[model samples]
Target: MSATAAERQFDELASLYEDVAPWPFRRDIEVPSVLHSLGDLTRSDVLDFGCGAGLSSRLLAGRGARRVVGHDASEGMLSAARQREAKEQRGIEYVSRLTPELEQRFDLVLAVCVLPYASTRSELRQMCASMARVLRPGGRLLALPLHPDHAPDPDYYAPYGLRLVSDTPHAEGGALRVELRAAGVEADVTAWYWSRNSIEEALRDAGFGPVFWADPWPPGLARVEDAPPALHAYLRRPHAAMLDCRRARVSG
Candidate 1:
């Protein structure tokens, strides 16, 4: 997880991120589990790092978060996010600058599919450090990463009898030329393939205690039901993870 690559790729694909994001339409694997893992917080200050399109930020605000500062490397996404926050009247502060503008502290830091894009260990470490720095001692951080063994192969995607193919690197999480007919849109997305172990170790190394994980989506409700038999079967098995963590204090 190298710094330069992840930032560069995110900056490149910021505009089209929302199209592939599981949003507005519907899905089971979503923010609830993420929220549940963090327990209840009424008016807690939150940070949505890599807050593309502001979906989760809006969700946090909708769920009684006092103030959610959205941070990302993509100006295009942040531009869209600002408009969205204005539309929702959510009073969210959106920042396109990652490290400098994110100097302020918060009650919680959410790293949603943000770190898997890191190309080197140092970049991944920085992402965790960013989350740690923003916390108010005893603050929480929620991070998600695709399970390595089940990581989505860039060459394969099976929809209801329609298969999507890409020459893009598998590490990108099949983001480019990404058209999901079932999901009903397209994009030049930038994503990543990462192991849960890699993600958890990074979090722990940054001084956060690991807490919880995400449940696989319920099929009857999401595209799982609509997916071809093979895909549906695969969906039932857990292929991703969400980690809940609390930043720790140094021993005196």
Candidate 2:
């Protein structure tokens, strides 16, 4: 399959991207938040839309999802994911394309850091449509996209081992340079900025119902007041936001 610009970039950064799994913010905040929002995966079939190294895909399988299919355009990332599946035998399937038989076959689509790869409004709508096509009616989509209200300061997320810089931070379809750093490993990727209104419109036009912006909270923490200083600060201005929406059920 031909690679998109984002896919090619990730193909080169595959190893470093896998290294990001253990980073504090991702391990402590992002993963748990997304998983919690996805409660009770038992017997569910899930699509991990941007399943780099199959991190979330493995998690879904461990959580008792009957089947997990990871789809990505980066062969480099898929190679790493397949190696893990070979060893662990988690029964997770990784592919570069979604076939006809897979259409409307999943109960959920877990799209971590996938939507912002769309550099245009049309691309964003197409991405949403792809997720919608693979989901059964009333199935859910859980995504993490760049927060429209994210702090523009390049250093704002430095404490979390992430940096986002944009010469045109407020402009729709503007490029955002994202840098991830941890344990002496660093990688950079490009994502586009889309306003919250634009995102909601795309989802709705793709046959999804109302969108819900869910707040991220650490798994073990009962309240935000209980979080430590650094965690609290990151939570207050997270660079990405969790979006939950469902496909509209067909009216008979």
Per-candidate TM-score against the hidden true structure = 0.74, 0.96
In terms of TM-score, the best-performing candidate is: 2
lDDT of 2 by residue, 1-252 (tens): 356786678886767877888877788889888888889999799999989888889999999998999999888899999999999999999999888889999999999999899878988998899999999999999999988889999988888888899987868889989988768888789999999999999999999999999667767897766876668878888888999999999999
- lDDT score at residue 156, model 1, on the 0-100 scale: 45
The segments of candidate 1 whose C-alpha lies over 4 angstroms from its true place after superposition are: 1-5, 8-15, 21-26, 98-104, 151-157, 160-184, 188-190, 211-214, 217-235
Q: Per-residue alpha-carbon lDDT of model 1 for 96-204, expressed as tens digits?
A: 6555545547888987767666656667777787778778778888776654544245334443212323354344333323334445544333445545666777788
lDDT of 2 at 144: 94
Output the number of the lDDT-best candidate: 2
Error of 1 at 8 (Å): 4.1
> Could you tell me the lDDT of residue 204 within candidate 2?
94
